[model samples]
Structures are given as structure tokens and as C-alpha cells.
Target chain A: MTLLECKNISKKYGEKEILKNINLSLPSDKIIGLLGKNGAGKSTLIKLINDLLTPTEGEITVKGKPIGVESKRSIAYLPERTYLDKRMTVQAVLTYFSDFYDNFDRQKAEKLLAALDLDPKERLLKMSKGMQEKVQLVLVMSRKADMYILDEPLGGVDPATRDYILNTILSNFAQGASVLISTHLISDVERILDEVIFIDKGQVVLQESADELRTREGGSVDEIFRRMFRC
Target chain B: MDFVFDNNIPIYIQLVEQLKTYIVSGALAAGERLPSVRELAMMTKVNPNTVQKALGELENLGLIYTERTNGKFVSCDSEKIYALRLEYAKNISAEYLAGMKKLGFSAEQAVIYLEDLGGEDFDTSGM
Candidate 1:
């Protein structure tokens, strides 16, 4: 069964159409990279899937149902912006998540927090931007959701922290769960991707397995993207 | 043992070669059980499916084996491992010689450089 499917999906804000006739079906048990440049409507597409925004046209299904409460429940999303309350302590935020999501694993989050040396008593506002990102990742990953959607996960962090983020994601990966990672930093996360969907100018220019893309293009995904979408 | 990857190459293939090197170098001792696929994935920061693919290749090469109920194990067949080690050694040695040759050294001079670098037993017969 496909984890998520978006058919003829398009979104508009007043006069600006962000995505156009987008068709994508994500299968279980793969790490798929959603590659695109800034302002390429990647965030808009993600928001549409999470039901944070309604698409102007077309439909999206999660586990074969239209985007609704069940679809929302099935997807664990980390949006580009931080959504945690600034005043809440790390432990308090974990409690907030646990109170909301039935699948949230408090114990697992605690373990990950300890591993990353993040203080549970510290307020989210007190932590550095990098640490905040890690904390957010820990919370999101602790949930055993069917599909994990991470947006710009590698942005604005040191390389070492970025690596930890990747390891945390992989470590929490459940069997048969698909991960849709939307990032512009192709080189950093490209190795872990099983499939890649390249979105250019609000449309999917290419969707292929990562290895096949590499083999066919005779270059890394980053290199191919550079040449394909050169300025 | 650090496993480095080349972005230009298929990651699973690199994993296979690196894991084989671990077996060949005794870093992964003979008959030792390997880590679970998820554990390996976290350690290497690759996807679980790709790591499994690499393990599958290692199993096909007889460098690793599955014990069914138990996890994968490095092969207990010491001779096969010895043969693999020799093959890797020869390939690496040839690469080193080629590098030295590219710097305008004759085969004999390259062997002398290898000797100085403690690369003993570089047979000069081919020269």
C-alpha cells in the first residue's frame, strides 16, 4: 500500500500558483528526498500534505484516504519553522507532545535528549538554534508514525549537528515506514536517500530511485541538480 | 574502522567493499556475529535497506553468513579469508606501484621506495 499519494495537486495563494498538477505516490520502507531550490514550492507542497493548507485543486491521500484526520494522524511532520512554545522546558514540551499524540514515545524522547546532552529542564528559548533543531528532531522521531516528513532538516546547523540529526532519524526509523525529507542541501543527505523527487518551478521534473538517477546521470544527485538547474 | 563513502559510487557497493575490508582486515573477527541491520545503519548513517543490500552482497561473497535464528556472522572459513586478504593486498600494492610509476619512477625504483616504506617482498621478477 502506498503511504501517501498526491494526484493533480495544485495550490494557489490569490494570484500565485505555487504547485501545479503535482503527482506523487510514496511507497512504504523508503527514504525519499524531496529536492528543490528555495521558493520552489516545496514548503507549500508539504503544507498541503499535512493539511496545514488546503490545495486549490486536486486531492492527496494518506493510506488511500483523502487528507483528513486519519491522514494527519499518520504523518509526523516537522515544518521549516519551529512550532514549540518558547517558554516550555524541554521536559514540558515532551509532555505537551505526549498529551497530544497517542503514539508519542516519552521514554524514547528522554533517551534521545540524554544522548544529545540536551537538558530537560532548560527552556526552549534558552537553547541555541542548533540545539533547538535537535530537540525538535528528537521529539518528532520519538513518535512511531507511519510516515515521517522533515522539511529543511539540515538547514542552519553545524555539520556535526547535521550528522547527529541524520543518525537520529535513521536510528528511529521503523520498518516499512517511509520518510519524506524535503531539503535543498542535496549533498549532505543524498547518501541516505533511496529515492529522489526533483521539484523545479513548482513541478516535478524528475522522480526516480536515487541509484538509478546516479547511474543514468553519471553524477551525484547534487552534481546533477547543479547542472540541471544551473543559474 | 572508519567507513568512507564516495558520492559518485553507489552507497551499497561502497558498504559492501568497506564491510568486506572489515572482515579481511580482522577488524571484524572470524565467526563474530555482525550488528543488526538497524544498528549498522545508525553507525554508518546510511539507510537500513542499503545496509541490508551490502550485507546481502557480503553473504554472497562467503565473507559473511547468516545463522537463521541468530544474526549474520563473519565466515569461519579461515582459508577463504586468507585468500581474500591476499587479493586485497595485491590490488592495493599494484595501485601504490602505479602511483609511484606515474611520478616517473621505474619498477625497480618503485620497489626500492616500497622497501624503504617497509613494503618488503615486492617481487622484482616482472621488472
Candidate 2:
């Protein structure tokens, strides 16, 4: 079944259009990469799916229903920016998540945090930016949601840590769940992506199987993106 | 086993090739039980679906098999393993000959150079 669908979606700000005629249907049990350069409206599309921003036209649906509280219940989102309170410790944030989301698995989150070498009792403010991001990822991924929407989960990190994060994503991914990852760092995430959606200037340029694109274009998704969107 | 993947190629295809290499080279011995898809995926740091796909391909190729609910295992057929090893050696030989040809050496000259460089005793160092 299609886990999420965006039909004729568009976003605008007064005279300017941010996204136009965007149509995408994400299937279950796959990792979909939303690839584009800066200001390509990747975040805008994500926000729309998460119901943070209302589309100017058309509709967005999760499991054939319009975005709402029910839809939010089944979608776990990790925003591009860190949203945790600096004063709160990782443990406190985990408790907050546990209380807020029925599907939040506190034990799983703790295990993931420990794997990253993050101290649960340590305050967010005391941790580095990358560590905070890892905590955020752990919290989001611990949920047993139908879909996971992560925006730039690999934005700031060392190469070694990036591999750890990718491994965590792969290891904890449950069956029948779909993940939609949006990022400008294509090469790092390309290997795990089942499908790739290229969005530029607020419109989807291409959406196809990642391997099929690699096989047909005779290069990695990163190379194909570079070739198609070169300056 | 660790695998360094080239992102240019399909990941499942790479998995299939790498697993084949391990089986033919005895790194993964015949009849050796393969890791579960999830375990393989975590070990390989690739998606589970990709691992499953590669395993499915290997099963179709008769390089691996499933024993009901037990688990997947490398083919125990000696003839099959031998034939696969021969095919791999042949391909490597063809590629080596082609490289030598580009450097202005005939197949006969390549064989002579190979004998002089390393006779019957194969040097496994720096491999």
C-alpha cells in the first residue's frame, strides 16, 4: 500500500511560488531519498507532509487519509534542525517523547543513545551539535511508526559517526515501514536508498528506483544529480 | 566479512558478486550457514531489502539455498562450487590477458611472463 501521497501539491508566498504541481506517492518498506541542492524546496515538502505548512493547492494524505492528528500518530519526523530543549537531559527528553507518542520505545531509544556513546543523564546543552542531532535521531527512530521523515539527518558529523548513524537507521528499521530521507549529501546516503526523488526549484524532476538510475545513467545517484543540476 | 562497495554499481548486484567471491574462494565455505537477512544487512551496513534481494538472486543461481525455516546456506554441491571457481578463474584470466594485450603482449607472452614472475608456488602476499 502507498504509505503517503502528495497530489498536485504546491506552496506559495504571496507572488512567489515555492513548489508547483508536486505529485509523489511513497510505498511502504523502502527508503526514499529526497535529493536537491540548497533552496530546492526539500524542507518545504517535508514540512507539508508533517502538516507544519499547509499547501496552497491540492492535498496531502497518509494511508489514503488527509493529514491530521491520526496521520501524525503514524509518522515520526526528525526535523533538519534540533528541536530539543538545551536545558533538558537526554533522559528527560526520552520521557517526554514516551509520554507524548504511544509508540515511542524508551528502551530502544536508550539503547541507541548508549550505542552512540551519548550519556542519557547529560544535558543537551553540554553535548556537541552532532551529539544532539544523534539524540534527536534516536528519539525519532525509536518510534514504531508507519513512516519516518528525516530531513538532513547526516548534515553535520564526522565520517565515522556518519557510518554509525546510517547503521542505526538500517538496524532499527522495522518491516513494512517506509523512510523518506531528505538531504543534499547524496553520496553518503545513496547506498541505502531504494528510490530517489530529485526536486529542484520546487518541482520533482525525477523519481525512480535508485539502482535503476545507477544502472541506466551508468553512475551513482550523486554523479547523476551533479550531471543534471550542474551550475 | 567486510565489503567496500562502489556506489556506482547497484548495491544488490555488488552484494551478489561479493558473496559469490567469498563462496568461490572458500572464505564462505560450501554448506556454511549464511547470516539472516537482518544480520547480513546490519553487518554489511546496507538495507535489509537489498540483502534479501541479493540472497534471492543467489538462490536462483543455485549458489545458495534455504532449508525451510532453518536458514540460508551456501551450496554444498562440490561440482557446482568447482564450476563456479573455474568460471571466476577464466574471467580473471581473460581480464589479465586483455590488460596485457593493451601493453603490447600476446597471450603466449603473458603466460611466459606469469611463469617467470610466479611459478607453481602462488604468492598470497599483498593480495
Candidate 3:
């Protein structure tokens, strides 16, 4: 089933075009890697999907309905920057999510916390950056949402923690839920992705199945990316 | 337990194939506990999610089964490994042949090349 659709979507920031006539249809059972260089509108595209920002032109829909607060409820978003208040403890974060998202699975959140060896009472402000990232992921993935839009999820974690974060993302979620992961670090998360969408200069250059692209291109996604974006 | 992951190939696919080899070779014995996802991640220095994906693929194929309290374990059915190996081999052979054909090797030339490489004498008994 098509979980999300963006049709001829365009966005502008102070007369500078960030997204140009974007069109995408996301299936419910795939993990999509959104690839782009810096300032390629990857973040802007995500915001449009989540309805955090409206398109200057065109339209988007979630399950055939227009983008709105109701659509946001079915989507779990992890932005590039830290969104949690640093003073809140792990337990408090869980409580906050539970209050906001009805589908928040407390048991899953607790399980993830236990696995990560994170104490619920520990304040976010006191934890290291890597630990805080984990906490954010835990809260995000604990939701039983139809779509997950994670932007730059692995931007700054240590190598050791990055693996755990990835594993938690894979193992924690239910089947058939679509995940849209946006990042320039393609090699790290390439294994779990079923499809990829390459964006450049506010335009989508390509979108294809991961396996098909690899077979046809005769190299890794990173290599293909390098060739396409080479100066 | 050792593998060289090609950037072109997905990490989970490499892990799945490598684990299959281990199973077929009996290196990872039936009923043996596989490494925790984190442990494998730390060992490979890859993302834990990559390791989890590999493990998840194995579980889906019935080559590995998870025991909730004890973690993931190798399947007791040894034949399953060989079945998986056969399937993997067929896929590799098809891709290899297609690649060779694309490189201008005729069917006859490819077979002759395989024969000259002593491919016929190689053991196919395992599968």
C-alpha cells in the first residue's frame, strides 16, 4: 500500500528554491534511503512530508488524506538536531511521548533502555552526546507509526554506539512500517535499505531499488554517488 | 565469522552468506548461540543495525531462531544450511554468467573457460 505521496512538491526559502517539483510515492513495506549533499533539500523534503512545513507549490498526502496533524500522528520523526529538552530524565521522556503519542509502547521503550544500559532516571543533560542520541532513537522507534522519517540519525555518534543505534532501529520496529532515512553517510546504512532516492540541488536525480541499482551500476551506492556528484 | 564486505553488496547480504558458510561448514554448530548483535557489531566495527539486519535475515530463512531469554541460536536442522547454500550458489552462478556474457564471453567460451579453470573437478558434494 502507498503510505505517503508527494506530488509536484516545491518549496522556497526567501526566494531561494529548496525543492523543485518533487514527486514521490512511498510504499509501506520498504526502507528508503534519502541521499543528497549538503543543502540538497533532503531536510526540507522531510519537513514537507511531516507537514512541519507546507509546500510553496503542489501537494502531499498520507494514506490518501491531505497532510495535517492527523497525518503527523501516524508518523514518527527524528530530526538532524537533538529535539529533546536536556534536563528531562529518560523516564520523563518516555512519559512525555506516551502522553503525546497514543501508540507509544512503554514496554518497548523500557526494553530498549535496558538493552542500551541507560538508566531511566538519568538526566539527558548529564549524558554524553552519543547516549542522548540513543535516547532519542529509543523514543522515536517505540512508536507504532505507519511511517518513520529519520534525518541524519547517525550524524555524530561513536562507531560503537552507531552500530547499536542501527540495530535498535532494525530490531525494535514492527514489519510493514516504512522508514525514510536521510543521510549522506550512505555506506553505513546501505545494508538495511530496500530503496534509495538521490536528491541534488533540490531535484531528485534517481530513485530505484537498492539491489537493482547495485547490479546495474556494478558498484556500491557510495561509489555511484561519488560518480554522480563528482566535481 | 570473518568476511570482507564489498561496498556494492549490502552488509546484511554479506553477513547472511558468511553465516550460511559457517553453518554449512559446521563452524557455527547446531544449537550454538550466535554472538549478540552488539558483539558482532563491535567486532566488525559496523553499525549494530547492520548486524541486526543480518541476524533478522537469518531468522527469516529459518537458519537461525531466537530464544527470547537466551538470545539467537543456530537452527537444529542441518539440512537447511545446505538448502540455503544451494540457493546462494545458483544466484551467484547466474549473476556471474550474466556478467561474463555481458563482457562478450559466449556460452561455449564461458563453459570452456570454466572447464579450463578445473571447475568440473571441484567438489559439489556439500550441497
Candidate 4:
């Protein structure tokens, strides 16, 4: 079933168009990798889906309802930047998530924390950047939401941590929930993705199943992406 | 056992295939202890979550079993692994042959090429 849909979505900052006439639907039970260059407006699209920013000219719906507090409750978001309070300990951060999200699975979150070797008492500020990213992912995945929007999830992490983060995402989360992951590092996430949506210059250039795309191009997703974005 | 991932295939699937290879080859002996998720993640430089997914998939397929406090171990049932390996090889070989045919190679020519590439003795024993 289609869990999320965006219709004729458009956004602008001053005169610069960030997203233009965007329309997309996310089906349940798949991992979608959203690809674009640094300024291809990938983040803008994510913000629109999470309702962090309002679209200038369109509407987004979650489960047939427009985005609002009710929709937000069923949607888990991990922004590209650090959104967690640095002063809070790992335990405190988890508690905050539990309080806000009714579907938050505290046990699952704690299990992930233990697997990552992150102490509950460790302050967010004291943890390394990679550790912090893992913490953020743990919280996001712990929520049994209908939709998960992860922006640049592997950004700035070492290769080892990247794999761990990817694994965590794969292992956690209930079936039938859709995950939308936005990233520029296509090669890393390409293997886990069921479908891929390529955005370029504020427009969705292509959206297709990863396997079909590879079959059509006779090459890997990264290769196809390079060709599509070739200068 | 170490896993070599292909970007063309999904990581989780690649992982499942790799574990199956080890089990089939006996390199990862039945009842052998598998690496911890953290250890595998650190080795592969992948997220622990991805590793967990791979392991979870294996468990679901009954190719591996978890011992809770001790960690996950390779399943003792050898036939299942062998069967999985056979199925995997059939699918992969079929895909490869189909691709070769699409490239204009006849069946006989494809077989000849496979033999010439020393794939006849292609050992599935080492995983």
C-alpha cells in the first residue's frame, strides 16, 4: 500500500526554487534511497515530507491524511544534522523519545545501544561524531512508525560505522513500514535499497526499482547515477 | 567466514548468500561460533544494523541459531546449507547464462567460455 504521497509539491527560498512540481508515492515494506548532488534539494524534499518546512505550492499526505501532529506521530525523522541535545546523556535522549513517540520501543533502543557499546550514562557531547550518529539512528529505528525519513544517514561516518548504521536500520523497524533514506553516497546504500529516486536541480529525474534500473542500464546504480549526472 | 559484497546486489541478500556459502563449504563448521555483529560490522566497515539484519535473515532461514548469552552459531543441519547453496548456484548460473546469451553467445560457446575460464573446477568448497 502507498503510505505517503506528495502532489505537485514545490518550494522556494527567495527566488531560488528548491523543489519544482514534485510528485511521488512511497509504498509500504521497502527501502527507498533518495539520491542527488549536494544542492540537488534532497534535504529540502525531506524537510517537506517531515513538515519541517512548508511547501510553497502543493500538499503531502500520510496514509490519506495531510501532514499534521497526527501524521508526525506515525513518522520518525532523523535529520541530516545533529538534532539531539548535546548535554543529554544517552539514557536521557532515549527517555525523551519514549515520551514523545507512543510507538517507541525502549527495549529495542536499549538493545541497540548495548550492541553499539554506547553507555547509557555517556553524554551526547562526550560521544564521538560516529557514536552520535549511531545514537540518532537507534532512536529513529526504535520507533514503530509508518514512515521513516533518514536524511544523509551515512554522512561523515567511517566505513565501519556506516555498515553498522545500515545494519541497524535493516534489523530494526517493523515490516510494512517504509523507509526513505536520502544520501549522496549511492554505492554504500544502493545494495540495501529496493527502489531509488534520483533528484537533480530540484526535480526528480528518475524513480525506479533498483533491480530494474540495473537491468535497463546494464550496469550498477552508481554507474547509472554517474552517467545521469555527468558534466 | 568473510563476506565479499556486490554493489549490484542488495547487501542483506549478499550477506545471506555469503553465510550460506560458508555453511555449504564446511569452512564455517556446523555449530561453529559466528563473529559478533560488532565484530562483523567493524571488519566490513558496515553498520552493525546491517550485520544484524543479515544474521536475522540467516536465523529466519534456519541456517544459523542464536544462543542468547553466548552469541549466534552456525546451524548443525548441514543438508539445509547444501540445499540452499545448490539453489543459489542454480539461480546465479541461470542469470549469468541468460546475460551471456543476450550478449550473443550461444549455449555451446558459453559453456566453452566457462570451461576456458577454469570454472569447471570452480571450487564451492572454500566458501
Candidate 5:
């Protein structure tokens, strides 16, 4: 079944159109990479799906219904910026997520926290930038949602920690649920992606299976992206 | 136990090859239950669908079998495994000879070089 579909979606901010007539359908039970360069309106599309921003001239749907509170219930969203409360301890944050999201899994979150070696007593303000990012990702992934939308989950981190984040994202998702991850670091997360959507200037230039793309292009996904979007 | 994919080759093909390697190398013994698709995906850091496709190919090749309500298991027939090992050795030998030929070495010269490098450890295998 289709997990999400955007039909002729367009976004405009005071006459400056960020997205054109975009039509895309994301299927269930797959990990899709949303790839784009900076200022290419990748974030605009993600925000539309998450229902954080309204579309200008089109409609978006999740699981055959319009994106609304019900769609939001089924989608776990992790934005590009940090939104955690700086004064909350790790344990307190866990409680906050559990209280806010009925679908949140406390035990799973605790296990992930332990795997990342994050102390439950440590305050969010004391954690380094990288640690904070990981914590935020853990909170988002610990929910039993039908779809996961992560914006720049791999942005600005060391290579070692990047692998850890990818592993966490892959292992934590429930079976048959879809994950839409927006990222510019193609090579770093290419292995885990089933499909890739290449957005350029608010339009989807290409959407293809990762393996098929590699075979047809005769190069890594990152290499293909560089050739396609080279300055 | 390590899956080092170069990411250029098709991932499912690489996965099938790696699982076959594990089976023939005895790293995954005959009749051993294959890890669940999710577990294998976690270990390899790829989509579960990719791993599922690889496992399906292995089943087609008679390298593994799935028992309903149970799980996937490596083929228990040792003769079948031995045949696979022999075929693998033949492919490796052909490639090795071709590489040596490029370096201006005949079969006899290749043997001599192996002997000079103390080829005693290779005696037990079918060289």
C-alpha cells in the first residue's frame, strides 16, 4: 500500500515558489532517501508532509487520507534543528515523550540510550552537540509510527557517529513501516536506502531504486548525485 | 562474519555471494539456522527487503531452505556443499592463472613460485 502521496504539490512563500507541481508516491515497508542540495526546497517538501507547513496549490496524503492530526499520529517527525528542552534530564525527556506520544516505547528508548552510552541523569544542556542529535533521533525512532520523516538525520557529524546513527535508524523502525530520510550525505547513508528521490530547485528530477540507479548509472549514488548536481 | 560491500555492485548480489561464502567456508555450518532477515539487515546495515531478496536467491540455488513456521536453514547435504567449494576453487584457480599469465608466468613457473613460498600449508586442499 502507498504510505504517502503528494499530488501536484507546490509551495510558495509570498510569490516565491519553492516547490513546483510535484507528484510522488512513497510505498510502505521501504527506506527512501530524500536527496537534494542546500536551498533546493527539500525541507519544504518534508515540512509539507509533516503538516508543519501548508502547501500552496496541491494536496498531500498519508495512507489514503489527507495529512492532518490522524496522519500526524502515524508519522514520527525529526526536524533539522534541535527542539529538545535544554533543562530536561535524559530521563525527564523520556517521560515527556511518553506522555505526549501514546505510541512511544519507553523500554526501546531506554535500550537505545544505553546502547549510545547516554547517562539518564545527564541534562540535555550538558550533552555535546553530537550527543544531543543522537538523543533526539532516539526519541523520534522509539515511537511505533507507521511512517518516519527525518530531515537531515546525518548532517554535520563525525563519520564514526554517522554510522551509529544510520544503524540506529535502520534497527529501530518497526517492520513494514516506511522511513523517509532527507539528507545530502548520499554515500554515508546510501547502503540503507531502498529508493532515492532527487529534488532540484523544488522539483523532483529523479526517483529510482538505489540498486537500479547504481546499475544504470554505473557509479555510486553519491557519485551520480555529484555528476547530476555539480556546480 | 564481516560484510564489506563496495556499494558499486548490486547489493543483493553481494549479499548472496557473502552468504554463500559463509556457508562454504564453514563459518555458517550445514543445517545452521540463518539469522532472521531483520537480524541480518541490522548486522549488514541494509534494508531488510534487500536481505530478503538475497535469501530468496539462496533458496533458489539449493543453498538454503525455509521451513514453514520455523526459519531458514543452510542446506544440510555435505556433498552439495563440497561441490560448491570445488566450483569456487576452480573459479579462483582460473582467475589466479590468468593473473599470473599477465605477469609473464607459465603454469610451471606459478607452481615453482608457490613452492618457493612454502606451499606445504596448501597441500591438504585441492589445489
Candidate 6:
């Protein structure tokens, strides 16, 4: 079944259009990469799916239903910016997530925290930016949601930590669920992606299987992205 | 059990090649049970779907087989595996000869050079 679909979606801010007539249908049980350069409306499309921003035209649906409370219940979203309370300790954040989301697995969150070597008693304000991001990832992934939408999960981290993050994402993976990771770091995440959506200037230029793309283009996804969007 | 991949190629093809290498090298011995797809994916740090595809390819090549109840295992056919080892060795020799040819060495000269190197402790660290 299609996990999520966006039909003729368009967004406008004032008189300027942010997204064109975009159409997409993400499949279930796959890890999809939403790839684009900065300011290419990648976040706008994600926000529309999450129901954080309203589309000026067209419709967005999750599991065949319109985006609303029902859709939100099925989606675990990690926005690009930090939204957690800075004063809350890691344990408190876990409790907060468990309380808000019915599918949240507190034990899984705790296990991930331990595996990542994060102290539950550490305050969010005291943790570095990367550590805080790790906490957010643990929280989002702990939920037993149908779909996961992560925006720039690998942004601004060292290479070693990036590998750990990717490993964590794949290790905690549950069958029959879909993960949508949006980022510009194509090479970092390409190997793990089942499919890739290349969006440029508010339009999707290509949507294809990652391995097939590698075979057809004779290069990595990062190389193709560079050749397509080179200045 | 390091499975490093070149991003330019299809990951499944690389997985198939690496697993074949393991099988022929006796690292993954014949009749040894294969790890679960999820475990292999985690170990190799790729998607489970990609790992599944690679295993399917290996199965088609008669290098691995799946039992209905039990998990997958390396093929127990010693003759088939021996044939694969010869094929792998031939490919390596061909590649080395191609490299030597690029440096203006004939096939006979390359063989002679290999014999000369084999007679001494050829340290690869300098290269």
C-alpha cells in the first residue's frame, strides 16, 4: 500500500509560489531519501505532510486519509530545527514523548540512549548540539509509527557519529514501516536508501530506485546530484 | 568480515561479490548457516531489502540455498565451489595481466615477474 501521497500539491507565500504542482506516492516498508539543495522546498513538502504548514493548493494524504489528527497519529516527525525544551533532562523528555504518543516505547528509547552513551540525567541545555540531536532521534525512532519523517538528520555532525546515526536508524528498523529521510548529504545516506526523490526548484526531477539509478547513471547518487545541480 | 562498498556501483552486486569471496576463501565455510537478512544488513550497514536481493542472487548462482524451515546455508557442493575458486583466480590473473599490459609488460614478462617476486619476500608495504 502507498504509505503517503501528495497530489498536485502547491504552496504559496503571498504572491510567490513555493511549490509547483507536485505529485508523489511513497511506498510502504522502504527507506526513501528526499534529496535537494538548500532552499529547494524540501522542508516545505515535508511540513505539508506533517500538517505543520497548510498547502495553498492540492491535497496531502497518509495511508489514504487526509492529513489531520489521524495522519499525525501515524507519523513520527523530527523537524529540521530543535524543538525540545532546553531545561528538561533526557529522562523527562522520554516521559514527555511517552505521554504524548500512544505508540512510544519508553524502554526502546532508554535502550537507545544507553547504546548511544547518553546520560538520562543530563539536561538538554548542557548537552552539545549533536548530543541533543541524538536525543531527538532516539525519541522519534522509539515510536511505533507507520511512517518516519526526518529532516537533515545528518546535518552538522562528525563522520563517525554520522555512521552511528545511520546504524541506529537501520538497527531499530521495524518491518512494514517506512522512513523518509530528507537531506542534501546524498553520499552519506545513499547506501541505505531504497529510493531517492530528487527535488529541485520546488519540483521533483527524478524518483527512482537507488540501485537502479546507480546502474543507469554509472555513478553514485551524490555524483548524479552534483552533475544535475552543479553551478 | 569488513564489507566496504564503492558507491558508484550497485550495492547488491557488491554484496554478491563479497559474499562469494567469503564462501570461496573458506571464511564462510560450506554448509555454514547464513546470518539473518536483518543481521547481515546491520553488519554491512545497508538496507535489508538490498541484502535480500544479494542473497537471492547468490541463491541463483548455486552458491547458497534456503531450507524451508531452517535458514540459508552455503552450498555443500564441493565441486561447484572449487570451480568458482578457479574462476575467481582466473579473473584475478586477468586483471593483473591487464594492469601489467598498461605498464608495457607482455604476458610472458608479467609471468616471469610474478615468478621472480614469488622467489623472494615481496613486501607490499612499499607500494
lDDT of 2: 0.91
**Per-residue accuracy of model 4 over A1-231 as CA lDDT, tens digit each:** 989999999998899898999999989877899999899999999998888999999999999999999889989999999777899999899899889889999998999899888778999999899999999999999999988899999999999999788878776767678889999999988877778999999999899988678777867789899998987
Give a tens-digit lDDT track for model 5, residues A1-231: 899999999999998999999999999999999999999999889999988899998999999999999998899999999777799999999999999999999999999899888789999999888899899999999999999999998888888889889999988898789999999998888899899999999999999999999999988999999999999
Query: What is the docking quality class of candidate 4?
Result: incorrect
Docking class of 5: medium
lDDT of 3 by residue, B1-127 (tens): 6766777866567777888788867899988999897577656544455677789988888989999999999999877777766887888788878987897776666666687684666443432
- The TM-score-based order of candidates, best leading, equals 5, 6, 2, 1, 3, 4
Which consecutive 10 residues in model 2 chain B have the weakest lDDT in total? B118-127
lDDT scores of the candidates, listed in order? 0.90, 0.91, 0.84, 0.85, 0.92, 0.92
Candidate 3 lDDT over A1-231, as tens digits, reads 999998999998889999999999899867789999998999999988988788999999999999998898899999888768889998898899999999899998898889888778899999999988988998999999998899999997788887887777776655678889999988888766778999999999999977678888978998899899987
lDDT of 4 by residue, B69-107 (tens): 999999988788778778978988999899988987776
TM for every model, in the order presented, reads 0.93, 0.94, 0.73, 0.71, 0.95, 0.95
What lDDT score is found at residue A51 in candidate 2? 96
Ranked by TM-score, the better of candidates 1 and 2 is 2
Candidate 3, what DockQ?
A: 0.18
Off by more than 4 A, model 2: B104-109, B118-127
Error of 6 at A73 (Å): 1.7
Q: After superposition, how far is residue A155 of candidate 1 from its true place, in Å?
A: 1.7
In the range B1-127, model 5's lDDT, one tens digit per residue, is 8998978877888999999999999999999999999999999998899999999999999999999979999999889999999999999988988998898777876776677674555342333
A57-157: candidate 1 lDDT, tens digit per residue: 99999998898888777789998998778999998998899998998989989988998787789999999999999999988888889999999998999
Residues B1-127 of candidate 1: C-alpha lDDT, one tens digit per residue? 6878888888888899999888989999999999999989888888898999899999888889999999999999999999999999999989988998898778777878667774565554555
C-alpha positional error of residue A25 in candidate 2 after TM-score superposition, expressed in Å: 0.5
